[model samples]
Target: MEPLSAEEIRRSFVNSTKSQVKSMALPAKFTELPWESLDFLGWRDAKAPNRGYLVVRRDGGVTGIAVSTQASGAARRFAGLCDLCNTAHHVSDVALFAARRAGTAGREGNTVGMYICADLACSLYIRGLKELDVPQGETAAPEVRADRLTTRLESFVQRVLA
Candidate 1:
């Protein structure tokens, strides 16, 4: 995914008077993150432990969601993995995020957040630097790919908030 502009991100929160973009407490090493690696902006708040948030701009609007470093403690009943890249994520890598959907049919509720490898350097294992090995091929099942992407999206969301 492409990076979103600050103005685009700001416009996403126009509907929610209660929502606001707060500064993230990124590790000093990651302070100079490049813009291209991000699909949206995510950050974690020092005041709140294990709490983070993400802002994704899509279809001319943005969707902001709150994320958590901890897992939901739920198992993955899904069959597929990530669509972009074929990789299987353990259940522990997934969590849930809450946000208000954009547009006329939008609703406010919880959404799934999963952590996958994409070099956000947000995961503790990577220490905010270095990329993990995500397989490059079309051998994995589509379901597995989709499931992986879902989890990865969640992970990416968490990193943005972190």
Candidate 2:
């Protein structure tokens, strides 16, 4: 991943309207982000807790989407795996985030949803930069895990675009 400026990040949004991009907030420590270690950029909006954002490099360009978070209703006693990073968390730590489709379909109320880490820190989780009680015996290398995350996230983005 390459370091991006605030203007670049705002311009990269594909699934958001001008106002959405204008109003969206960057991560709390944007300038200090470890861009080289990121597979994508994702964060929850500080001003609007239900709103989340994701930006990724695709085909040499960037695409970003705004999503709304919804409760998954998973039982508290069970854990769920984030579809993006395959990291397991208590059900409450995973959420269903829905992005309105791009263009006409989105205007018509169409949306795509996926289960993801509540904090949207899949990259850190995969790199062991964050702590989670990962299940035993799942020893794939970090690069391999990152590749999988990129594939899965892009698939979700494609769904929103499609």
Candidate 3:
């Protein structure tokens, strides 16, 4: 992944309005992010825990989406795997986050949701930068896992765009 500026990130959002983008907050220490180690930029809004953001570099451009957590009762009772990273997490560590669809579909209240790490730290988890008490149970190399994470994440983003 390449480093992104605040302006680029704001402009890349496809499902949010100018005012919403203007109000969205970047992750803390945004300038110090480890870009090379990130598959996509993701974080919960500093001021609004329910709101989350994901940004990825595709072909030659960037795409970003704003997502919000679903109501709490939807969480699983046992450990769950993250759809994007295939990482296992305690029930409390995973949550269902939903993003409104892009364009007309979004205006109609359509949304897409998937179970993912609550902290939006899939990249770090995939790269072993973050410690997990339980194993991911995959035999792939870190690079391969990273590639898979990017593919899955992009697919989810595509669904939102569709």
Candidate 4:
């Protein structure tokens, strides 16, 4: 993934209103982020804990969406995998989230929900930066996992826009 400027990130949003983008906060370590190491940028909104954001470069343009974090869906300490990156986490670190559809459908209350990392840091989790107890015997290499992350995330974004 390439480094994205604040302007680019703001323009990337597909599922959020312009005002949402304008008011949204960047991750706390935005300046120190290692952009070259990212498969996509994702973070829980600081000012609005229930809100989250994801951004990626797709087909020559930047694309992004707003996600709403609901409470944890799993009752056990460790349960399901994050739908995007397939990383296992303590149930408390994984939560249900939804993205409103991109247009009038969203205005009509349409949203797509799934379980994802509580911090929205699938990129770091995959690379071992934010460690989680991954299940044993998963054999895909890091590069392969990164590719899958981007592909899966794009698919989710498409669902929001579709």
Candidate 5:
């Protein structure tokens, strides 16, 4: 994935009324992040913690989402297995972070996940894919299906930030 410029990021988030394109602060150690490991365009925020970053792609059009490693104390009442990989996250592996669509609809602060390596693609990896091997006692609804999981997470992130 190619790195995105600040202008590209700002333009992508034109629809997000609530989201602002500010520099992210990243931890100094995070400088070693493997950009090549990502599938979509990703970048670390220079002004904020190094853990702060953004990922962008053309889901239908130019859709960009922001991500941060900062954790929230909000308790998790909702428990469900990942629809894609079928892994159990005990509400911890699954966290509610903030995000927003990068276009006209970008004002929404959606919630997303972090530390989701079970599926390997962060949000999408944990969300079940066709090849995923779901574990026993783990079930997901159509609304929480793998494909929709990422989008749902994004919405959750928006709510948290908002």
Candidate 6:
């Protein structure tokens, strides 16, 4: 992923209105993100407890989406697997986040939700930069896992735009 500027990010959102984009908050470490290791940029908003954001460059432009955390419940008692990285995380560290679809579909209240890491650090997780308790005996090579993570994330983003 390429390093992005605030203006570029603000103009990238597909579902948010002009006002919403203007009011949206960037991630806490927005200016210092590890862009080289990421397939997409995502984070749980620092100030908005239940809000999240994701952005990726595609089709010659950037596309961004806002996400909201679903209410926690008994379902959260069990470990959850992130759909994007296929990583298992502690139930408390996994969140059901939903993004409104792009364009007209969004205006109709269409949204897509999936279990994801609460910290939105799946990129680092797949790259072995984050410590996980999972066994590594059957794991694929770092490059392979990274490629798969990128592909999976792109597919998820496509669904949001579609």
Whole-model lDDT per candidate: 0.43, 0.89, 0.90, 0.84, 0.43, 0.80
lDDT of 2 by residue, 82-156 (tens): 999999988888899999999999999999999999999999999989888646344899999999999999899
Lowest-lDDT window of 10 residues in candidate 2?
A: 70-79
Off by over 4 Å in 1: 1-11, 14-31, 67-87, 100-130, 133-162
What value does the lDDT take at residue 23 in candidate 1? Answer: 48
Write the residue-wise lDDT of candidate 4 on 1-162 in tens digits: 789888989988888888889999998989899887788888888899999988888896988888998655545655567888888877777878899998899999999987888888888877878766646345788788888988898789789889
Residue lDDT tens for model 3, 63-118: 99999995445545577788888899877788899999999999999999998888
Q: What lDDT would candidate 3 get against the real structure?
A: 0.90
Which ranges in model 5 have alpha carbons more than 4 Å from their true place?
14-19, 23-32, 41-54, 59-62, 66-71, 74-87, 97-162
Tell me which of candidates 1 and 3 scores higher on lDDT: 3
**Candidate 3 residue runs with Cα over 4 Å from true position:** 71-77
The TM-score, computed over Cα atoms with residue i paired to residue i, of candidate 4 is 0.91
The list of candidate 6 runs beyond 4 A from truth reads: 71-77, 133-138
> Measured by TM-score, how close is model 1 to the native structure?
0.42
Q: Which segments of model 4 are wrong by more than 4 Å? A: 71-76, 134-136
lDDT of 1 by residue, 1-162 (tens): 355555555454422444334343433334465555444455554665466555555564566655555524554544333222343344334333333333342334424445432222232222223333333334655445445544666554444334
lDDT of 6 by residue, 50-69 (tens): 88888888776888888899
TM-score per candidate: 0.42, 0.93, 0.93, 0.91, 0.40, 0.88
**Residue 114 local lDDT, model 4:** 79
Q: What is the lDDT of residue 7 in candidate 6?
A: 92
Worst 10 residues of 4 by lDDT: 71-80
